[model samples]
Target chain A: MQEQWTTTIRPVSGWLNINLAELWRYRDLIALFVRRDFVASYKQTILGPLWFLIQPLFSTVVFTVIFGNIAKIPTDGLPPMLFYMAGIVSWNYFSSCMTNTANTFVANAGIFGKVYFPRLTVPVSVIIINLATFAIQFVLFLCILFYFTLKGAPVHISPWILLTPLLLLQMGILGLGIGIMVSSLTTKYRDLTFLVGFGTQLWMYATPIVYPMSQIPEKWRWLFALNPMAAVVETFRYAFLGVGVISTDVLAFSFGMTLLIFCIGVILFSRTEKTFMDTV
Target chain B: MSDTVIKIENLSKEYRLGTINHGTLYRDLQSWSARIRGKEDPNSKIASAGFKVQIGSFMALDDISFEVKQGDVLGIVGRNGAGKSTLLKIISRVTMPTRGEVKIKGRVASLLEVGTGFHPELTGRENIYLNGAILGMTKKEIGRKFDEIVDFAEIENFIDTPVKRYSSGMYVRLAFAVAANLEPEILIIDEVLAVGDAQFQKKCLGKMEQVSTKQGRTVLFVSHNMAMITSLCTSAVLLDSGKLRVRGNTSDVVLSYYTQYSGSPASFDFRSSNKFIGDDHAMLISGSVVDSEGNVANEFDIRNPVTITMRYRVTRPDHYRFIPNFHFYAPDGTCAFISGPQEVTTESGEFEAVCTIPGNYLNDGTYFVGLALSSMETGVKAHFYEQNALSFNVKDPIDNVPTRNGYAGPIPGMIRPKLDWKIRGVA
Candidate 1:
């Protein structure tokens, strides 16, 4: 009885008590969840982690044939394989994080109903796991970049390549923010779950994944730059191939959007985590 | 606040009867606009008591307040659906309370169900780490107690094997072992002891005792087993229909619950009942206990005979024999004996089975009878089973006779038959 607890439980009034320190204290749990998610998904498959590379590799070939060769999509003078692979890898990471994080509530309701942990740990682990997957695919992209360099294709490595990690970080935060917000909303309105997958697919075409940002007419280019992912993909292309749009305006707009989405996503997720069990 | 590990004040929870949020977005939007326009929602009307309510809510836990002192083991006893689980859920933060507050000292770990987050593909060692992390233990804490946990579970031989490959008993032991080793300041345990063997239960009780006494941790234990509650808990609370019925010393609270439970009825009405579990090939119409002359009796003379009459209507009776049975339970909740009809017959019409319990065979105490109807075949399939259908008291009054040299306290054991004995004087 000498040392008293500094903890109390009361009905939540409105916004969540977003305790960053509590989330920090649960860092090990987030790490284990990340490990578990990665290990369990590919445990019995013959291609274990090879699926990570094979997924984007196979998709890039299909995109090259359909969109590059037949559709006559301009790749800004970069090799079609290089162009498509970049889009595929970056888009795959964002979509997977979004889709998985969106299902975090319905998927883990069983465990959450029986135990108490920082609910934010679940979504944080999803982001980290998807980031690791992106790293693996990035290695594959480097190998392909090496082959093209030896063959002397006009693939200029710009100094802007130093900003690739920043681009990926922006995409990660944006996807995570939307995913958590959707996960919370879908608890009360289950129709949102059915729409999230289809919405993510349509969103890929809206970004510059299939076509370069230069292909858009000058008058409509401002409208296209509003998509935060478009900025990330275009900058990623500009950083590596030195042929796509890169400006202070696009980067500043993307950062602003990512911050807003991430904040709202966390607030919604933390609030829903308290009473989602009652509805779910 | 420092002396009390858990302080609950006016805690309550209300649950909607059916689908959450009115089951559609249209109704939700309606309510939202109503709030925006500063008007009462059209759907927020309370139903009168006499009418059939369409969509309504009930309070599972209603304004209950209590506290648990540091290092005190408090037992909560109640019948099923008495808001016991709801109370624990609110305290553990699995769900939030609808109103009021709870303040606690230090970390709290609740084991509502054992092995809650165990993945089947993970090995026992991996699962221990996973479960420990879920319960708020750091990786280093689990690693330090790894060997101690393995030894306590007695599953070192299968530690490396996947948990799915372990037998259910082994799985339970491993899960319980991890939970018992958690060194939280306050621990909450539900009815997880009913799964393991008796020996394992005893071990868990011993470990819990150590956790509270030696380590000075506060514990809140919920159990239906009064014997266990009386032995392991320092104090107890009795809940009845979402209210705190009584709270005091463990033995005193248990006695209050026992007396309240046995004071109900000598017969159960088969009508107006929905808590029945069976295929319903046949249904129990009525059941009661009576003397040989057919008078309803709640108090039986130990020297006489008592008959249990059960009336059931059979719908499908062409296949096998209908066996009606009675399971006698002593006051401490142990099955005393099971008696049923021996001769077999096939009958389809409504029938009554009267089985006589010969007196002078049972001890002087309160006894409860449970009814069961099964098909008397090679593989006995029970059609229906009902618990606590009828309860009665048995008393033995000596008339100008001396027994055990005027010993007047009470006799022990399930039966107190007067067996013949021969004694000789020794020089």
Candidate 2:
């Protein structure tokens, strides 16, 4: 367990312990924060949860037109719409998790400042809630691929799809890490809000979202590979579309970065949660 | 039986009043300048020489030591900024101590504020579990006590509604229910009950009593209500300026606190002593309410001037910097009214702050007067008297008459002071 955090006293927050027992006692609260994330955003909206499916569908169409036709980028010989949709489904999950997790401290400071809980439960639940929505969008993407394959489009579903769970974890860990880091900093300097929105878009470009990894320059390929999301999306294309162009080395790099960022993010977040109220 | 379930020994907390952005050019400059001047840096306690008391670092809690026995309700009372909440926050694990240690044998739950850990979009039912889990309750425990919690909160019907749609009462009920259901070994409440209505307050009191006496749980309740502390707490701790005054039997501590209230003559003196004490351009002297015949009046007659007389020191002409101010606080601690000179008390000599209460203005009750004399130009206090604060009670002219608009029933606010009145009409 590596010292198992004998004491977690950050300079900002005093002595905020992981306190698993207290966290276990308040397990119901984790479920509540999850429910809040799931329902609160969609409340009074016209489409409600249906909006989850529409996001990837709309993006898939727009990307198919622009990147497939106008830009004429190779979708690794697969239909550009299906190719981008798969990546979008995965990207949507990470992006939402990142955004929601980043807002954790600012959004829930009222609760956090007044009560004690395993602060980890908040970002953890946010990861879970958005995963559920992303899960729905993923299903829709799969149904589309099935329909396109029936119409005689080249479609390949590999057993690497089984590796989806690991890829998902990699994405969650990375998102959680980055989200927690930004969330902690956002308390002191809220300037991150706009940067995250714009940076996420730029980050997608670096990760080969609308483009394939093969299009990246070989020497600079390592650069994109470092962005964990690029590895997830590349592995995803390899799993469903049989785009085996990705190197195993790139994924190993992604995994290493994921764990590293997640560890650093957790430490920073736990430290920030203690005194965020004083500054926030 | 252990005499103390919680032992807090020599707890000290030091806080830096200024920012510490170290490793910066400005910081190096400041530290270097401090080294040359032999003064401490404004941001840190360290003198350039090292660890000296700087003007910036303040010890919020200095060697605070106390012990709470099982089943004892201890009240920590203090004025604002007196380190009361900070101590409670430290004990509750919501904050940490800078120095010293506290040992607790059992679980501790704190209600420093209400609606904590509540999700606005979540339903009451969902939030109950969510808040319970956040408070360190297991799911099974929350499930088991779910029904009782709903019943206690009296929000069962709206349990499925999002708390955002709830009225404040419903919101507080759900929040308080979750907090109340936390069966920690020790409960810490920090003036949070001020959110509840009188009925809910009584209910919370009953719950706290049950938790302490019936369940043998130790409780530390921080409040300003001497009456509640006197009645509900078994022991009390009085905190003044971040230091302990007395901690012993509740009645004795409360009696000592109330002694500061029994004297009303100071109210008159504070009001009338302005002739010599305040800026002489406007000084108050020998001022007291008097009967029609100019005799010192023990109490105000409804028709009396409530006369306030003052002697002033007129050092020269056109010295209009003197202004008399009177601030009143009701028995319930709500600021009632602040009145002052409508016209300049020029031509210094002595001046007084006085306002005659029109008949029927006040509801019968005890009230306090906080007097201050300030410079009219800068509005800074030339002289303020809080130590000599005065307390007075209005006697019902007709003890049985029992009626005044906006004065009946138990209401909490400023201006509960009573006055004599009559309603007349042409028949």
Candidate 3:
């Protein structure tokens, strides 16, 4: 009987135990959660899934008007509409994923208290659902990209376009990592819950969403590149519009930082999952 | 000597009293440096008073150890704060234990709350799949069982409707159906049966009975309803103040629970209870049981006349004619009787209303008395109502009232009033 025991629960022993196999066993549950999140968001709305296109489309329009036309910000030789659309498409996915993933523990504390599943399934599904949303909006961006290309706008498409999926994956991983870390901290110090929303807004400015990284002075450009999301957005534009500079050194730096943040997030999240019910 | 499916050893859970893990890191830093410097911590000196208050944390479950055998329906009986839910949480791995370990064999599914993962906006069919997946069932498994679930829930017509539009009864039925069909090796259920109507509750109990007896699975049930425990469980454990008080056959354990606590005279006091909910139309000060001699008692012989008394202060007398009432509840939570004052106008003052029951009227059982003050003019507008305001035991051990017709078990009824019988033989 002792040898055949299926599971053992105790005070979390020595180092962290992240049973990726256990998470794999709950893969169906992750899919269901993804479906639920996707469906429940637009269940009774008049626009339904069209609201997905509306968000980034409207944000691009605003950025094009305010930064491109009014403020006269340079688009690095690409059409302002296509340039802002590219940035918005990638940045929106990352930011929304971060916000939703950061709220995983606090929002689902009720479900967590009553049921036992791999806690990682929740954040994983958050990434997946946001990815689904990004895919839909990516289609909308492509339509605009085709229109700009056919109109003979000065956009140079590059071979790096094949790396678009890889860029999105990096952003998703980075968001999940930072989000879970914040979620763990916010469980006890709920002050972070309020600060996350405010900080994400501030974080957007620090990233090159409204302005290009080259627009920043060369002395301060490296500091801007340190924001992992800057590399992701820059790579996205370089791949699609083929105008923004692609630095392997900076891209490597961002990828390494994302990997580090993800490791830290997993460690904190695993530690927090052991006793989050008590604090949450 | 049976196969033990669950073994809990020296189990204890310490819960921080006021705040949970707040400023914990800062305090740990302070205390850790103090320990290194060979000095007492500055914040460890203040002693919090009362039972639930602690300077930092207190034990919710303390040194409780028990074993549950396979296929045994185990009843976990306790007061509200006796750590029953905490015990189940640890066993189900919903929460981690603080001090001990629980070894569980095979798959365990716990319905700590009904509809735990149910989303209101999702259709009933979708929610069934969602809740099933949350309980560790694969989608293919849920699909295979979907027909049986819809049939058992009796909601074939509403299966496609979002549960938000469902009546509370329908929601609970579908939720319970999904849970009952999980077919795990071990099942842990809290007091979720109180949600549905009587017929649904009966169906749920029957399903549970079939699950344990026919399927040969283990079950751990927690409920305040002693009658249900006595009828459903084969064995039981009683918890008192986070400690194991008794463990044995269900009848003995429940009887011991009744005697150990309910039989005490001082345990039925409602003077300190703030259960009275009202808008200041009236307020209940105390409620208790009194013998024919007019002294408050917790234990009573069946042949002795007893009176249920409630003392209250009427703040607004002219608002409506007050009907101060007493509700007698059997051990199974059924309302045995509801008696109140006559329809008469009364003034603002302190008043004590007593309803006396004659000797040989009530059957032998543990009973709870509730106090209610209502306005008859507005058609039963309750001004102050407190459920389970007081409790007592009705015993018939002396053969004073010959109720058993050569039967060994207790007689069933709310009342056992004796009537004169005549017999004539035409030989």
Candidate 4:
């Protein structure tokens, strides 16, 4: 029924031309992994997915107590609770993605060594699952947003809400970029694993999540927004509370930095996927 | 013109053994020294070996090159640490080569180990998609073949159960089904069939045959099982300590492997000091099986029957009830036969325990023999023999068996002793 068939092959010139068809081939796997990440994280847990809401909610209360009252950090004229919630939600999302993907090789070495699949799917699914959790947390922000709106509180859901999707995109890409960069590097240098936890902690302060960009003196304000995550958090507050600083310059610079990091990260990741097993 | 689906020019890999990496604290000092002196750092051995040697660093593979046409199942036979897995990893794109290049066409899938992409907490169905995707199979491809995979794995009910709950057998069955169903343009497997029950292993071989022979997918299989290689692969290559030992017909390459491991009898350094086996009654000080050439030949051919001479020292034969047990194992770790000296004499003595694997009885492959002097009457083993005792290889006498089957890996229920066959009626 079949005649003999054979084909010739050549070394792929370079990895620049990543085949989209191959990725499309694994679309269901991406979806399944995302679903598994989300479902499996809460499986049989007493709190279940409610933990998603609880995280930002609890973090907001803690920040309101420690930073809002204890440290006397200003929330840029908005209610301390809402101001901290926005940052917590977004920050946690990226942190989760980073944490999930950073261990890609160490966690799945057994599988990666055994079978061949586009290695990116594992990290990409982390972004998807964390994004879903962020959406759940976003609903909590809305409940607070509505309460403040009804209380005749001074607030505005700026038309800048249109750009919230951009924030999500930024979070996804930046998380993936940094996560992959660290994962590819950590395959050999495991010191990064220990550093990541504390690093993310210090990184949150650098992002202005508990304080406002305005709290910095005018001369020092430039340094505040230079932190890519700082600009993102500031802009998100500007959109929801209409009270934090927002600038095209800050967003554009952050975007550029994010794009650069992602490019470098993906390049390193692709190169490492070939030989990660040996080192990891 | 396009028959060669795979082509290699020069391939090599090096691994550093006994290497200790310099601590990161010394990084600045090393770099500073290199920059100031315009010379390499003194401790640059490991790093230089990594970048400089490429494949030649320690040379796991030294300039190996070969081609496999579509539908050609290529077997890579090598000893442990011989770089067979490294070659497969590079070709599969799971790992890059230290030197040379591999050009792969078509989608590739690999099964270097069972449950490669499985998440312990994920159910079998979820893992099917995850593992399939990891193997580069599209969702539609996985969906189209989902039922077939489950059916073949015989884990339909368990498909919804978390894979962590699955037994090792179920895990292997499902893993193989997902991998085999990928139907890649190129399938690279590395000793995954070494596990699993006999029936499942047979199914796996049958599936591999169907994938390569029927589906026309090119297969690159790495294994220590020469019987499987000889039977399934159309061509073969042997690697010996990072170099191509032989490359040609499957039969020739397998023979080359066997012959190299089949040590020469002329160089017997008698009193060569074989392993010790004893139970306080009798202890084996030294012994060796000399071939027909009157030299030490631990390994023999399928049709060759030889004598086993042993020298033992008996210490106080009274109340020291023990027997010398000799076991014969097929190459795939299957025991062909075993015999004990006390099967006849319940007495202990400085005796020579000799057992022969009757001629034409064991199907060709490697075999291991172990001598255990144990208290047979008391049923308490005073001493145990392990991975070392006695070992040998049996080569296939190709003249008799024209065609062989690929189902020759770790068969369950030991004693692969070949038995006489007769058909009373054709069912």
True C-alpha contacts between chains kept, each model in order: 0.66, 0.35, 0.71, 0.46
Q: What is the TM-score of each candidate against the true structure?
A: 0.79, 0.73, 0.79, 0.78
C-alpha lDDT (0 to 100) for residue A115 of candidate 3? 76
Query: Where does model 1 sit among the CAPRI classes?
Result: acceptable
The CA lDDT at B174 in model 2 is 73
Which stretches of model 1 miss by more than 4 angstroms? A1-3, B22-55, B112-114, B258-328, B331-333, B337-427
**How well is each residue in A1-280 modelled by candidate 3, as lDDT tens digits?**
2345666667677557688998998899999999998999999999999999999989999999999999999988888989899988898899888999998888989988887899999999999999999999999999999998899998877888888778888999999999999998888877778888989999988888788777888787879667999888988888888877669898989999999999999999999988889877
Query: What lDDT score belongs to each candidate, Candidate 1 first?
Result: 0.83, 0.71, 0.83, 0.74
DockQ of each: 0.43, 0.18, 0.39, 0.31
Higher-TM-score candidate among 2 and 3? 3
Residue B340's C-alpha lDDT in candidate 2? Answer: 73
Off by over 4 Å in 4: A1-25, A70-72, B16-56, B225-235, B249-252, B262-329, B333-427
True contacts kept of 2: 0.35
Alpha carbon lDDT of residue B206, candidate 4? Answer: 93
Model 1 chain A worst lDDT run, 10 consecutive residues: A1-10
Give the number of the best model, judged by DockQ.
1
lDDT of 4 by residue, B1-427 (tens): 5766777768767665443344343564676688699876666655666565332346777888877788998999988978787787667665666667666667777874666667788899988887777777767888999999999999989989999999999998988898898888888888888789999999999999999988999888988886678667889989988888888888667656754664312122224555454555566665456566556765566566655545566775656565566666554555667777636344655566565555555555555565566664555654444332455555654555322334434333332355666669778
For candidate 3, write residues B323-404 as lDDT tens digits.
Answer: 8878888767798988877654568888888788887788876677777888877577888777766777777775535655
Q: Which of 1 and 4 is ahead in lDDT?
A: 1
